[model samples]
Target: MAVHGRTEAQPIDLTQVRAYGDTLNDGAIALSFSLPVPYGDEAKEAARQLVRQMGLHDPQVYHAHDLGEGYTWLLVYAKSPYSVDFTKISVPKVSNHKLSHAAIEDYWHEHGGGEKLRVIGACTGDDAHTVGIDAILNYKGWRGDKGLESYKCFAVKNLGAQVENDRLLAEAAAFGADVILVSQVVTQKDCHRTNLAALVDLAEAEGARGERIFLCGGPRLSHPIALELGFDAGFGPGTVPSDVASYLVQAVVQRRRENAQPI
Candidate 1:
């Protein structure tokens, strides 16, 4: 296809272009989502037919397994015959430096140690999941790295699940905490957002909002949403203790520098 008075050329923006052929092109994508079905060849054929009916071509079931009693799981690949303008989409992002655990420890040592920086963590509001919070503050490590308990300068107080916002704030004040880490595991009915918001509100009411590094972690929490909800950072699943520890120590140092406070 040649344009008049011009040589043949490809589109500068190939964002919305979809290629059609047997080979996987740049537009090709593999998708995996669960559907309640029995594990069998019938289920696999049904999945392929469903994707084909949805306009995808060459749908192939790579693997299928029985999730449990009467439940099935699948991984499939197919050529999607759809495309969208990538330039038309936008997303929020969190901007923060990525530092290793060694760098963080070095920074703490250089800044001055033995100050006993306090941190309070809990799983707030009727949510009984302590695994996330424990992974951050407990003596044991997660994913082959030492937790905050290994840091000599940190005084970590982990208040377990179902904690109230008022209680958290009161304890923070009492302990003169430098940071507060909140973990929410239950997002059922949007309860996680509500509880997170309430904690922020309570911290503001107690005049300790800006005095500490407020962080939240869960399977669904993100940095953008956390920033929007007034958190310094939000960590999701697969987050280890060192990640949170690194962030907290750096945040404290940054805050002190910004405030020009002598420590």
Candidate 2:
């Protein structure tokens, strides 16, 4: 229990957590989807029955619209009968805390031993989008944060888009890269996953896997998904240049410590 002034608040049970709206433990949920049917009274009933089949109770179709091509969109409200144990959830995440652009620059300058961290970034494997990679590697970064190229601690070489895996690895070798950043914005047919996994495989084949850190990012990628695809870490939407900068410097420091090398 928590007390605020003279009032007390009940502790939430983590073992049976459910969605709440309008009232605590109400389990109210809103769902929206489209079906291949014309909008009518029958369409509303179909949506309600479909929600019931999904194990939701008291499903009420609040809105329906016709798409003019025999398609109907629906919005429904219902009560979810199931709950999840919040304590059982576990996720792999980047270990670095949020550091400001200035703070990261300061730390790297103080401990970097006069050596710049070399980073090679590209949008590999037929991906034409450069926005994600440029936001992290170019001097003109996304939003208001300055990118890695603007920092004195990092030596950045952005290879632009649609780079092949072997060429990217060759460039990393030639640049003596400390980190390799790959971005895949085109995810149609799971091509991003295929390309990222192939890059790791090629690096391993060339005995270059353990020499540098491999990081990938995209709209569809997450840290867990990146791990599954054999990347060191992954970034997704809304990630600023400072976030990647902070993670790489800290990761380099950690790796150097593990190998008993100077920072």
TM-score of each: 0.70, 0.83
Tens digit per residue, CA lDDT, model 2, 23-137: 6577889999998988899889999999999999999988999987989999999999789999999999998987888888888887777799999999999899998999988
| Residue-level error in angstroms, candidate 1, position 237 | 1.1
| lDDT at position 237, candidate 1 | 83
C-alpha lDDT of candidate 1 relative to the true structure? 0.81
Clashing pairs in 1: none
Cα error, candidate 1, residue 254 (Å): 1.0
State which candidate has the highest lDDT.
Answer: 2
Note the residue pairs that clash in candidate 2: none
lDDT tens string, model 1, 58-172?
8889888888776777787888767767777766643456567787677777774458778999999999999888988888878787788878768889999999999999998
Query: Against the unseen true structure, what C-alpha lDDT does each candidate score?
Result: 0.81, 0.90
Q: Which ten residues in a row have the lowest lDDT in candidate 2?
A: 1-10
